[model samples]
Target: MLTLTWRRGDGRCAFLAGMLALLCYISPASAEDGYDLWLRYAPVGSSKVEGYRSALGNVVAPDRTPTQRVVREELRRGLAGLLGSEPRFRASPAGDAALVLGTPASSPWLAPLRHELEGVGEEGYLLRWTRLDGRDALVIAAHRDIGVLYGVFHLLRLVQAGVSLDGLDVSEVPRIKLRLLNHWDNLDGYVERGYAGGSLWDWHTLPGWEDPRYTDYARANASLGINGTVLNNVNANALSFSPAYLRKAAALADVFRPYGVRVYLSARFSAPMELGGLATADPLDPDVRQWWREKAREIYALIPDFGGFLVKANSEGQPGPQDYGRTHADGANVLADALAPHGGVVMWRAFVYAHDVPEDRAKQAYNEFVGLDGAFRDNVVVQVKNGPIDFQPREPFHPLFGAMPRTPLMLEFQITKEYLGFATHLVYLGPLYEEVLRADTHARGAGSTVARVVDGSLESHALSGIAGVANIGDDRTWSGSHFDQANWYAFGRLAWNPYQSARDIAAEWVAMTFSPAQEVVRPVVDMMMASRETAVDYMTPLGLHHVIARGHHYGPGPWVDGGPRADWTSVYYHRADRDGIGFDRTASGSDAVSQYAADVAREFNDVERVPEPLLLWFHHVRWDRRLRSGRPLWDELVHRYTRGVRNVEAMQVTWRRLEGRVDAPRHRQVAAFLRIQRDEAQWWRDASVAYFQSINGLPLPAGEAPPPHPLAYYLSLQFPYAPGDGR
Candidate 1:
C-alpha cells in the first residue's frame, strides 16, 4: 500500500521522508468501490506512521470468547490495512506501546480499575493510557466482551480519522438501546423502495453457503455501533416464518452474532393462518396467541439471541388486529408476550391511515395511537415515522412524538432516498434528520425536543431505539451512489448520540471516506450540509409535500388525482387551486393542528406564529398574500423553484473542482450523477411552475425561464420500470 526507501547513512532517505511527511495521508487514488464504507483504513503518511506503528505494534487481547476473537481479528485487519504491517500478538504487554484490551474477567490487569467502569454500563467501554507490567500501554477495558469489540472499532475509527492517541481517555455508551436497520427487502431478491441493487441476502443459497459479504455487512454495521437488523420488508410474506425460512434467518443470526449485530425479522401478522394450521389469526384468540408463543420458542431455539420482530400491520393493505376488530394494542401485546420471555421486543409500526380518507391524512396515526398510550405491553415499542405524512422532501415533525409518552416510541427514519431523487441526486439527509430531531414538542414544557423523546430522556423509559430503513443492496458500492453512504453513517452516529451535530458527522464521514486533508473535507462537507435544502427548494419548498408522480413517486405530479384512495394522490396533500394554494389544516379546515400539544397547536394554528416554511402545510393562503421574504406567495414559490435548480448547478461546479483530490473512478461517478441531478432539478422546477401557473393564470417572474414545451409535454412522461418500485 505504501513504498519505503531506506539508505544507510545517506541524505537521500532523509529527503524522501520529508516529502512523504509533507504529503501526509496520500489519497488511495487507486480504483475502489464504496464497499468498504467508512471503515477504509488506508495507510497513513510518514509523519504519523511511525507513531501509530509503535502504539499498535502488539495486541494483548484474549481470544477465548467469540466477541473477543472477532475483536482480535478486527484489530489485526485494521492495523495491517492502516500501518501496512500485521501487529504482533502477545500473551502479555511487552512493547513500549502495546494495546491491552479485555474486561476485568478476561484480563487480570483490568480488575484493579473496576471502580473506574462505573457509568460505562454493559455495552459501553473505557479507553485510556495506563501502565501495564511497568510498561506504557493503551488499555481498552469494558464490562463485557461486546463492549471490547465496540472499543476496538472506536479506536480504529480514530486512527483512520488521523486523531492523536497520546492522551486517549474516552468513554462511549450508546444513547439509544436499539440501533437497528429495517431492510425493505423481499425474499425474491426484489426491494420495495430500495434504490441500490438487489437485496443483500441471497435466499436461494442461504442456511448452507454463508457468503463472506454477510460478514462484511456485519463489520460495517458494527463499526457504526448499530446493534440490530430487521431482515425483511415490512410488507411481509408469511412464507418467511415457515420452517425452511426460519432456518435461513437462523443461519444469518449466527454470522452476525460475533460482530454484536443481532438479526430481527419482519413478522407477518397472519403467519398463524398461513404458516400454521390455524383457522383465524386474531390477537385476542387463545389459539392465535398460543401459535405466536410457539413460534417465538421455535425461533429462539435456533438463534438464541434473536432480536424479535417488526410488524407493519393494518397499513397499505397489510393484515393486522384491526381485521379482527381489535385495537393496535391487542395486536402488539400477543407478540410482545411471546417475545418477552426471550428478552425480545415487538416494534409495531405507526404508519397507518384508514381506507376511508380522513379530513387530514397527517392526523390519522396520532389519532389511532394516542388513545392507547399506556395500554401496550412493556416489551412493545411503537415505531413512528419522522414526519406525519410519508417521507417527503420536507414535513413538520409528527405530532405523535410527544403524545404517547406512556409508551416507548422508537423513531424511524428512511435512509433510502425514495422521495429526494433516489440515489442519483446528491442530497445528504443529515440536515433533514437533524431538523426533525431538534424540533421541540413541548410535551412537558420547554426543552422537550424530539430527540429527548426518542432517547427516553423525557419519558424515563428503560427501552429506547431508533431505526433507519436500510439503503444497502447487492450493489458493489453498498448504497447505489457513493455519497448515499453518508446517510447510513449519519443515522448510526445519531442513533449512538441523539444530540450530536449532523455537520460534525458529515465532516467525520468525509475525512474517513476520502482524504483527511482539509482541502477535500471542507468543500465536501459544505456541499453535503446544503444539499438537502437545495433538493427541498426545488422539489417541495415552503412545506409543499407529496407532490410526486403516482406509484413510482419519481418526478413532479401535482396534477395527479383519481387514485383508489384520495390520500394516495398528490392533489390531496397540496390542494392548490386558482383561488389559493396549500392545505388548510387549522381550525378553519381540518383542525389537524389540534393533535399537537396545546402550545404547539396554537403556534401551528395561528398564521403569524407558524414557521414560514410550514405555512402552506397548516393554512391555505391567497397567491397575493405576503410572506416573511417580502414577496407574494406566488413569487416566493417561483423564486424557490429557480433557486433549487441554481443550487444543483453550483454543486456540479463544486464537484468538478474536486476532480484530482478524490479517486478518479469515484470522482467521475459523482460528477456524472451530479449532472443527472442538475437535469432532474430543472425538470422538477419547470414542470411544477408550468402546472401551477395554469391554475392561477399568473405571468412568469422577470428573467425566470418558462417551460421548454407545453404543460402536456411534462405530464406525458412515464416510468414503467423505475428501479425501486418493485411492484
Candidate 2:
C-alpha cells in the first residue's frame, strides 16, 4: 500500500533515485524482464511500510573497504526502493531507529559482543536488536567485511519478504565452504547444455571492456552467499589459461573481489601438452608437474585470490592421468600440490565412465573413488554429482556420498534444466535438491544424511562445498526463463544451509521474485513444491531415467537405440520388454544397490521394501506385478504418466488465476511457458505410452486415452537444431 514519493529536501532523493536505478539495473519502463531477480526491492505493502521505515530509518556503516562500500550502496539502494524513501545516512548511530553495520574492529561499540561473534567464524554474521545511544538500534556485525555484506543482504531479504524487523535476531554461517557456480561456457561464447542464449561472458570483449553486467552478476551471486564461480566449461579449452584470456579472467576477478566472489577456471588436464608443448601430460612426469606448478604461480601472480581449478578428467573422452596408466589421485595431486602453496583447493570431478561398457553406469564412480578415499591430497576435494547417474529427473543419491569418509566430497548439482524441459517447463529444483540432501546415507549407524557428508560434519573433514552447473547466459532474463532463475537462487540457499526446507525456500523466492501477497505466494509455492514430482511423473515415472531423445534430449524417445555406445542410448536405462519395464540392480542383476550402505542397500535390494517411486530402479518385475496403488505395474505407469500431464494442466490453471495479481509481462510469459509445458507433458505422456504399449501390448487402463499417433510417428520426430546441444 506504500506509494512512491519524492523527497523535497536538498534534492537528495532525485540524486539517490538515479544512483539506485543505475546500480540496480532499473529500466525506463515499469515492465519486468526478470533481470533484477530476487534482489528487486519493490516497495512493501502499506501495512508494513511504516514498521520497516521505523526499523531502517537511519544507517550507520563504514566504507573503508570495497566490501563495506558496496554494503552501504546496497543498503541505500534497497532501502530507498523498499520504503519508497531514502533513509538518512549517518556517521554514527543516533536516530531512534538506526541500522548499524560493521565488524568489531571497525565499530568499537560491537567489541562487547565478541563472545557471541566467536561462533560466527570469519564469514558469518550476527544481527540483533539492541539499545545504542539509549535508543532502539539493529546491529549487523560480523568478524569480517564480507560477513557484514552477507548480513546486509540477509537483512534486505527479510525486508523484501515482508518480515517484521522489530525483534530481528539472526546468526548465520554457511554450512558449505565453497558455494560455486560452474559455467559450462566455452571461449567462443557457446554454453554447453545451456538453454539460455549465448554465454554471459562476451569473450570477444573482455579485460578491456569490463561489462557492468559482470558486476551485477557478482552482486546476484553475493546476495545468494555463493563465494566462487568456475567461469569456463568443464570441457575446458587450453586458451583459457593463455595470457590474453588470463588477463580477461583477472579483470573479472577484480570486479568480483569486492563482492567476495573468487574466480575459478575449469582447468584442462592436458594443458601442459597443449600450452607448453610437453611430450607427455602424465601427472607423475617431472616436467608435467613443474609446468602445472609454474602455471599455478603465474595465475596467482595475475589474480592473487584465485580459487583454483575444477578439473573434469577421464570422463566422456576427456584426457586424464588414466590415459597414462595413472589413477585419479595422481591426476588430482599434482594440481593440488601446486595450489597448496597458494591456499587453493582442487575440485576434481568424479563423473567418470569408461569407453567399454560396465555392468551399470551408475556404479562406476563409486567403484573408481571408494578405493582411493584416502589417496587424495589434503587440498583435493572430489566433486560428486547428487546422483550416481547423470542429472536424471529423479535419482537416488550417489552412493559415494557416504562411501568416501577420508576424502572431502563436494556435492555437484546441475542448476540447468538439462534433463528437465530446459527453461520451458516450470520445474523448481528446490525439492529435488532437498530430497537429495536429506536422503539418509546410513553410513555411520542410523542417520548419516548426505547433507552431513557434504557439510563435513559426518566425517569431521576440514573442507566441504557444493557446486551448481549454472543456467545463466547473455539473455535478458539471465536464465533463459523467469522460473529457471529460482533454481540458481535455491542452489545458493541450499548451499548456505543444506538442512533448510525446500518449501520455505520456494516461499521466500516467490515473495522476493513476485508479490508477497498470500494469494500470489501460496499458489505459486504450491505449484513449485509439486513441480519436480509432476515432471518426474510425466517424463520418467517409477524411477525411469534417461529416456529422452538421442541428441538434444528434447522429447520422449523410449524406442531410441543403436547409438555409438549402448550406454548413451535410452534403451540402456529403462530396459523395457514384454515381461517388464525397469532395470534390475538387485543381487540377481547388476548389484549396483550394493554400493550403498547396508541399511540402504537392503531396502533398495528388496522390491517390497524400496520406495514405490523408485520401484523400477532396483527391481525388474512382471508387467502384471501389483503396485502399491493396487493396479498392475503397466497400469500404474500409465496412471502416473497421465497424472503428470493432468498436474501440468492444473499448474496452468493455477498460473492463470494470478493474471492480474502478478505483473503483466512476467505473467504472460509464464502463462505461455506453462502452455508449452502442458503440451509437452502431453507429448511425453502419449509418446511414452505409445512406445511402451508396442512392447507390452497391454490394453489401455480404464478412462485412459490412447495416443493420437503411432509409435513410429513419435520415433520419426527429429530435432536437428535444438538449443544447448553444442558438443
Steric collisions counted per model: 0, 2
Predict model 2's lDDT versus the native.
0.92
lDDT of 2 by residue, 509-592 (tens): 999999888999999999999999999999999999999998888888888899678988888988999999889999889999
Off by over 4 Å in 1: 1-31, 95-97
Give the CA lDDT, 0 to 100, for residue 423 in model 1: 92
Per-residue accuracy of model 1 over 1-727 as CA lDDT, tens digit each: 8867689778888888888776654444333678788888887766888898888888888999888999999999899988899988888775454789999999987887699887898889998898777887898999989889989988988888788999999998988999999999999999988989999999999898999999999999888889999999999999888889999999999999988899999999999998888999999999999999999999999989999899999898999999989999999999999999999999999999797888889999998999999999999999999999988888899999999989999999999999999999999999999999999999999889999999999999999999999999998889999999999999999999989999999999998898888998999999999999999999998889999998888998999999698988988988888988999999888999989889999999999999988988998989989899998999999999999999999998988999888888799899999999999999999999999999899988788889897899999999988888848
Clashing pairs in 1: none
Those runs of model 2 whose alpha carbons end farther than 4 Å from true positions after fitting are 1-30, 95-97
Supply the TM-score for candidate 1: 0.95
Colliding residue pairs in candidate 2: 1-45, 1-46
How many residue pairs in model 1 have overlapping backbones?
0
lDDT of each: 0.91, 0.92
